[model samples]
Target chain A: MEMKKTILNPEGLHARPAGQLAKVATSFKSKIEVIFNQKTVNAKSAMSLMTLGIIQSSEVIIKADGPDAEEAIQKIATLIDNHFSV
Target chain B: MSLKIIGQKAAPGMVHGPIFIFKKGNSEINRSHHLFSDFDPSKETLLFEKALYKSLQDLENLKNKFTSIDKEKIDIIEVHQSLIDDPEVKEQTLAKINHENKFAYVAYEEVISLFKNMFSEIEDSYLKQRVLDLEDISNRVLFYIINPELNFSYFSYSQLNDSRPSIIISEDLTPSDILGFEKTKVLGFVLSKGSPQSHSSILARSMEIPCLVGAHELETLDLSKYTDLILDTENSEVILNPNINEVKSFEEKVSLFKFKQKQLFSFKGKKTETKMGKLVPLGANISGPLDIDSVIKNDAEFIGLYRTEFLFLDRITPPSEEEQYETYRTVFQYLGHKRIIIRTLDIGGDKEAPYIRIQKEENPFLGVRGIRLCLKEIELFKTQLRAILRASNFCNDLGIMFPMVSTISEIKEAKKIFNTVKTELEQSKIQIGKKINIGVMMEVPSLAWILKEVSDEVTFISIGTNDLFQYSNACDRMNNQLQTISSPTHEGFQRFLKFIVQEAKKNQLHVGVCGSIAHHPEIMPYLISIGVDELSMTAQNILTVRAQIADL
Candidate 1:
């Protein structure tokens, strides 16, 4: 399952948001990956998510594979859509 | 060639010394495969977790240390805590140790480096600054993994010798790091990273150490090669490997600074008088009894403004009447005949106390503070008054002053409370002093207009120029962005001062000027000419102001 979301935060996906995304990815038994600027990184790894340099207004593709892939995609998509306020 | 690196001047002073590069954490890690050869994968992962736990504990301790004193510093420490708890960084480090069979330190370094590189590449300057946070966390984890046996002291003050003063060159200094070093031994600070508003920078300023922040090129410099360097905060430049002429000029300035100090010291015992032999009473503004020695040493005639709020701040509860009485008694006993004017509790606004329970306001500077806070908390005000009255029994020359009185009714109300306290003390058979002068700090603009009305009620008036300038200019003195407009020397402010002095003289009231503007060499002569009967400032400036007055 795959979902596309725009980075809405004025600060973009910095350390804080990257940590949030990574935390959400680890909760589900699925291999989650975030694709930005033709580069795909493990959504479960903050260092990898950060390396993609996903910035404000940038489009990102979140892909999840395994039994809970659909749920994983939805959770992460909601986070990015909500601009990681929590 | 003398290379000049520019940065924001965090503190003011000039000094030349050998550069001491103090990087936080152990950056030099042995990446050799030997350390990782016998590494049990699960054991290595466990070691990494343990290091993270230790780092988190250290950060928490640091946060607690600064929690009461500085809120901004506590926020910085909290950021580090969150960075350490980031699940991705932890998982990646564990994966490297488990899957790649790398040492814990090496794995941590790789992950930190990856994040650092990514942060550095970000075009946004604010986001790019996060690289420092990443580096700080990585260093802490690596330090634990490499030297588990060695305990780390956040401030490595014991390692440096007192005999050899050095300029600390670092990527960034945490407030804890700056606090650890002896102010005397650390002559200056040169940072590769730090904003002017950083707590470290604020600490440096309070310590009076020359500091230059945001010197990006300092991180790349071969500090070992350049043994001697000049940190000139006045010019906001750091000169590395200065030539003969540069060294000569720097030494000349140091000698001049020393000579000026000596010159000022020569006038310490002499009466503060003009060349024409007109004596002007010079005094020191003290925060507490601790500054009594400085007041005597500086030969100040009296304690002009004893700020009493220090006792109420940084505490869980307001000081009791007995506690306040003891402190006031100590000051009065020490000063003896040297009259100490104690300003009643002036907390609120910038000097907020958590225990005081003031509502958060959009413009706290103009909010319920000083006498206004006291007016609302009547019991607290009465307790302080009773204490002051009790302390007055110890000495003859105790002057009581009310702060932040803008209207005649406020003075009338304060005086009513004062009379009630005095009557209560007398009724209790307390041996109060025969004559205690009552005064008001002339800070509010409205008070200046009604000086004639106030002069009848108060025995003396002390113009607190710090707030007067801020109030008159409608600028927040503490706000760095308003530096240009917040000056005390504005023509309008000068006119206000002149008018107040004139009105004070017409009403036959002893008017003195106290604040930063009081002892300023250039401002002193002008104030004297404008009929300011006395000037009070920090004890350190008494000698300087005396010398300046003598010259006039």
Candidate 2:
């Protein structure tokens, strides 16, 4: 399962948001990856998410593969869509 | 031979000490040697984990230390902790050690550098600055990894157990760095780069530590060779390796300064009076309840100016009336019978509250601020008035003063609100003092001219010379460019003050000078000679001014 979302935080996908994304990804039993600027990185790695330079209003693709792939994609997509405030 | 390096004086005081130079980036880290001769991947990874854990613990301790007092500092420490705990950082560092055959320090540095470079390349300036935080964390971890037995702290001064006080010479001092240091153990500061307006310098000044900024060519000097140094901020000069004669002269000056300070201590509990027979009240201008100790130690007769704005600053929301009342009650309890003249909120201008939503202005000093702001924000102003009125029931000597009033109408409007608040409080069966004196801060030059009209409306006036001097000269006191013309000693400014004093006397109104100028020893006699009824300054200056007044 895959989902596309735009970064809504005015501060962009900085450390805090990336950390949140990683934390959420690790909680699910799915292999998740985020693709931005032609580079794909493990969604559970904050350093990789941050290095993508995903700034405000930028779009990224989230891909999840496993038994709970659909659920993982939904959760990760919602997190990014809400701009990681949670 | 003594080398005299001139710089801008950021804070005023004098001290002599051995120099402790702090160069950023911890350039002393030994990059030439690897942590292990032959790479053992698990061992190296364990070493990294140990250092990371230690660094995290140190940050946690710092966060706890600052948790109660400083919100901004706590947030910064938390960010550093999160970065250290970032799993990706740990994973990447271990991958380098296992695959690349690199040592622990080397692997950590390389991985951290990669992230730092990536952050720096970002278009956002704020994100770019985050690279400094990463660098700070990296330095802490790398320091621990290099010397496993030694403890790691970002600020070296905090860890030093040396008994001798030292002067700090640094490339730049951040607010957190200043906060981390044991202030009493640090005698002075000389920075190669900093502005007087920077938070570090402001903190240094408030802490009363001597500081000199923009000391060019400081970084190139062999710091080890010039261990003993003299920081003479009065002369804006730092003396390196002074000769016998220079040291003797410096010692003489130090003794004279110390002697004067000692003499002032004798006058602490003594009455401040002229040599003839004129008695004047010498008091302290305190910001909050915390300063009551200084007020008592200095034997202040009253709190001439209780600046209430300190409670309003550095918070997201305005203080509630109950909160303000509790603080005011504590202050009253501390002072007991000692009179307190509480100046209402003087926000805007240099001091701003984001929650208030004041419009940006080209010249805030001349814009809607002080009483003008209070008038516009009537509900906020009324809340404060009600709090003070309620708190007045706790003390016999409570006075309310409005700031930045330029017209009779502003005074009338403020007084009307005060009366309304008093009535509301009384109707609610709250016991309030009817003897609470109402006054105005004689800051705006226009107020000085209309002393008759002002005296008709109020019981007293406190001349806020800092603002009066700036407003009268049309020069920003904080602007370095206007240093020459912005002086309070300008003859024209003195004449204005003299005129205001005369007008107050004619109207039989109590008048006082409560400003930084009132703290100046030389200016003390001039203010006394001008017939000002009282002098209020920072509590630290009370004894000094009193001793000077005794001599006069």
Candidate 3:
């Protein structure tokens, strides 16, 4: 499963929000990957996500593949939509 | 070998213990020239996996250990945790070991370096700063891979547990190492190289660990010969292999230090009062939310000066209302009910932001700055005002203070903008604090003479004696030649303070001094005697100042 989302944080994908995203991605069994600016990285790695420099309003595609792929996409999308408060 | 090494003091307090020479970044695995072909790939893989597992567990434990700290600090540990066993990092490391014929530590270092370089190239300063976090995690994993026999817990380490706490002697330490170490089991730190401003030293100071840095003699001496050592950060020297007399005297010093610390701690919950029963509210001058812990630890009656300029100084663009609101609200959440006086953006003197462009002037200090700069940049001023007003809803006692105000109109203009922002928010149905106090920093000397006129514009005033001293005496504070002239003891400056305090009392306005001079030993008495309502100083000085006030 795959979904597209815009980073809502003005200081986008900094340590705190990136850590939240990675923590959420790691909870699911899916092989989640986030692709931004044609660079693909593992979403379950905060360091990997931070290297993307996803600034405010930058749209990216989140791809997940496993038994829980659908649920993983739903969870990650919610996190991003809520400005990574989760 | 008995020797004395002089170093710069990074933190205070003293202890004597055996020297634990921490060889950071000196793992044999890191220095080895062995290629993947020199060893079994399967063995290297297993070794890497074990190190990775141990590192993950340590990260988990560190995260739990730091749970009581602020959320941002915990987020750092969590970031390291997520990246420790990251499949991406693992895949890259395995590729280096198998395909590139590199050892596990070498492979891991290569991957971390790659990410570090990648992060350093990024334009966002905040993301680029995370490179330090990467280095910290890499060091931890490398330490585990090399020294599997050494237990990761510093608290339960055999050498530390055998006798007195060990003084950590390292070339330098990462901030995380300082944070993750069991501070109780450690006497202090003696780094051969580091500056007082280094993050590690800052962490050492914050953690109240006695630390000495820049001991160049340590490089020549064989550390193995020095089993016992005295870390006297007060004297800025470490005594190696002291004589019985030296030991006995040093022991007395240590006990005295501990007694002084105990006395300071005892003042934590007591009211700051002089012998004459005059109650003086003591507060801390903080730069941001990070200082909230120290402020509370010192039992400050309030935050007298919260410099909001830190939020604006570092970024490519001025912080949006929401960003500033979040920052202010976080401070409010931490302070909870403590009266906080936040100074508006005082930029363009020593602090310059790329986003806020001011024409280079002959004298930037006398040029556009503080309220003058904010007034010229009305939109920026409004944005900050809106944020402060929005966050004021979170705290009961919030004071908005404008800095370097020289005229009545400037205060009225700032208040006008603030009132406009407040009204806009109210019209939008936003709830703000019902009674947010207004104040101004009395930095301009001209304003001192007209306190009666300015007092009506604001409920409180804080004398910014640093700038006020320099400006009043026509002495450049930065110039060494003007040191004598700019001294706070200058009869002119002393008289100015007394006059202002008298004027403030007559005007029925709460007045405080948020300046370096507030904690000056000789000047504190005059300030207290003059009936200043509050004295704001650095967090570290709170306990000592309180004790002094109590004695007086």
Correct interface contacts retained, every candidate: 0.31, 0.31, 0.44
Worst 10 residues of 1 chain B by lDDT: B25-34
Instruction: Give the per-residue lDDT of model 1 (tens digit) for A25-78.
Output: 889998889998988988877656766766667998999999999988888888
* Candidate that would win on TM-score: 3
The candidate 1 chain A region of ten consecutive residues with least summed lDDT is: A8-17
Model 1 C-alpha lDDT per residue in residues B1-552, reported as the tens digit of each score: 678898888877899998887765443543354354687888778778888888888888766665332434555676677778767788888889888988888788898887787768855544565676676667667767765645445324555544488998888887657755766778899998887755577677655678999999877777778877999887889999899999999999989988998888888777889999998989899976656666887889888999998777643346656557777777777785777788998977666465466888887779988899999999889989998888888777878899999998999999999999999988989988767989999999888888889988998999999988888888878899988877777788888899999999999889998879997767778899999999989988888888778879
The digit string of per-residue lDDT tens for model 2 on B316-367 reads 3466665577788878877858888999999885564655768888888888
TM-score of 3: 0.79
lDDT of each: 0.80, 0.80, 0.83
B391-459 per-residue lDDT for model 3 (tens digits): 888888899999989999998998999989988999999989867889999889888778898878889
Runs of candidate 2 with Cα error greater than 4 angstroms are A1-86, B23-45, B59-134, B153-166, B173-187, B196-209, B222-227, B275-279, B285-299, B306-365, B373-400, B412-438, B448-459, B466-510, B516-531
Q: Runs in model 1 with CA error above 4 Å? A: A1-86, B1-12, B23-159, B170-186, B189-226, B233-237, B240-246, B288-297, B308-337, B347-367, B379-396, B419-435, B469-499, B520-523
What is each model's TM-score for chain A? Answer: 0.95, 0.95, 0.97
- Ranked candidates (TM-score, high to low): 3, 2, 1
